[model samples]
Target: MRKYIIILISVIIIAFGGFYMKHQYDKKEAELQYFNQAKEKMENYLHENYKNIKEINFSDSYSINPMGGISVEGYLNGNKAKEFYGIYDKSNDEIGVSSVDAEEKSE
Candidate 1:
């Protein structure tokens, strides 16, 4: 009887551990998806609006806004000192740029 109880507890623990791991994995996956989408949206926005920008690099950290959108900070043309902020609005599938200091290139 004691052996059976031990086995039962062990099984329960393993099941719960598996469930927790799965939940964590799903959460991370969702976060990664959001990050990728936000990065892509920001890149597209910059390319369309800023003709001189040839390269884009985003920071590793981001924030979640009150409206459930993702906000990120990045720099253009390999200049890390000059940073720009952008937000990806999930509901409207739009990206808004703010505090950009990138100058337009002469044609």
Candidate 2:
């Protein structure tokens, strides 16, 4: 009985581990796809518009929980990549799209 239990437990562990890994892979794949699309759009917009192209805005991090009263999907503006975005409000932090701090560009 002990041997049988050990085998069963091992099988369960392997199954759960595979499921978790697959879940993680799917999540990462989705994020990568979203970033690719967003980057293309931003590049197109900058190339076509933004005459002089001083800066651009992108979203860095975001979340929306209606039940928790939490919302964060702010904006970012910058002339180059690796921008540092900070704000007074907590609900204003993005990663991929709104990572530009538009205010800084005006100056």
Candidate 3:
């Protein structure tokens, strides 16, 4: 009976662990998808509005704050540019461009 109880508890713990892991993965995946969508929108907006800029580039730098705010860094026409894209809402396809900054290009 003692051995059986230990085995049962082990199985239950493993099952709970698996469930928690899966839940975490799903949450992260959703956040990733939202970030991608926001990035795409920002790219499109830059291309259309910032016509003089030859290239709008994204770097490896990215961050997600505790409140789920996202920030991404990149380059604009060879100058460093960073943008803060606020929380994403699927129902509202419009992405709010919170802030954007670009270093002046030097001759």
Candidate 4:
């Protein structure tokens, strides 16, 4: 009886471990997709507001906050320009640019 209980407990533990790992994999995939969408939106915004966008640069790090907000740093034509911050709605895969400022930093 004791051996049977131990085996059952082990099986339960393994099942939970598998579930947790799958959850993490799904989360990371979703985050990557969201990042790509955010980057694309930034590029579109830059093209509309600035000329010669080929020279633009952007910081490597983009913060996605717990509240689904995205903050990105970008330079226009090789010089520091407005920063972007907004919320990403997963239901629509859209980023809403809340504000663009020249000196804003990620929190």
- For lDDT, the strongest prediction is 1
Query: Per-residue CA lDDT of candidate 3, range 80-105, in tens?
Result: 53433333334556444444554333
- Write down the lDDT of every candidate, Cα atoms only: 0.84, 0.46, 0.63, 0.65
Tens-digit lDDT string for candidate 4 (4-60): 999999999999999999999999888777777777777666556544455546666
Candidate with the larger lDDT of 1 and 4: 1
Pick out the ten consecutive residues of candidate 4 with the lowest summed lDDT: 98-107
lDDT of predicted model 3: 0.63
Q: Predict model 1's lDDT versus the native.
A: 0.84
- Estimate the TM-score of every prediction: 0.87, 0.51, 0.70, 0.65
After superposition, the stretches of candidate 3 with alpha carbons farther than 4 Å from their true spots are 60-70, 81-89, 101-107
User: Candidate 2 lDDT, tens digit per residue, 67-89?
Assistant: 22222222324445434332222
How are the candidates ranked when ordered by TM-score, highest leading? 1, 3, 4, 2
Clashing pairs in 3: none
Better of 1 and 3 by TM-score: 1
Supply candidate 4's per-residue lDDT for 34. Answer: 70
Residue 32 deviation, candidate 2, in Å? 0.5
* C-alpha root-mean-square deviation, candidate 4: 6.0
For 53-104, candidate 1 gives per-residue lDDT tens digits of 8788899898887878899788888988878898889888988646666875
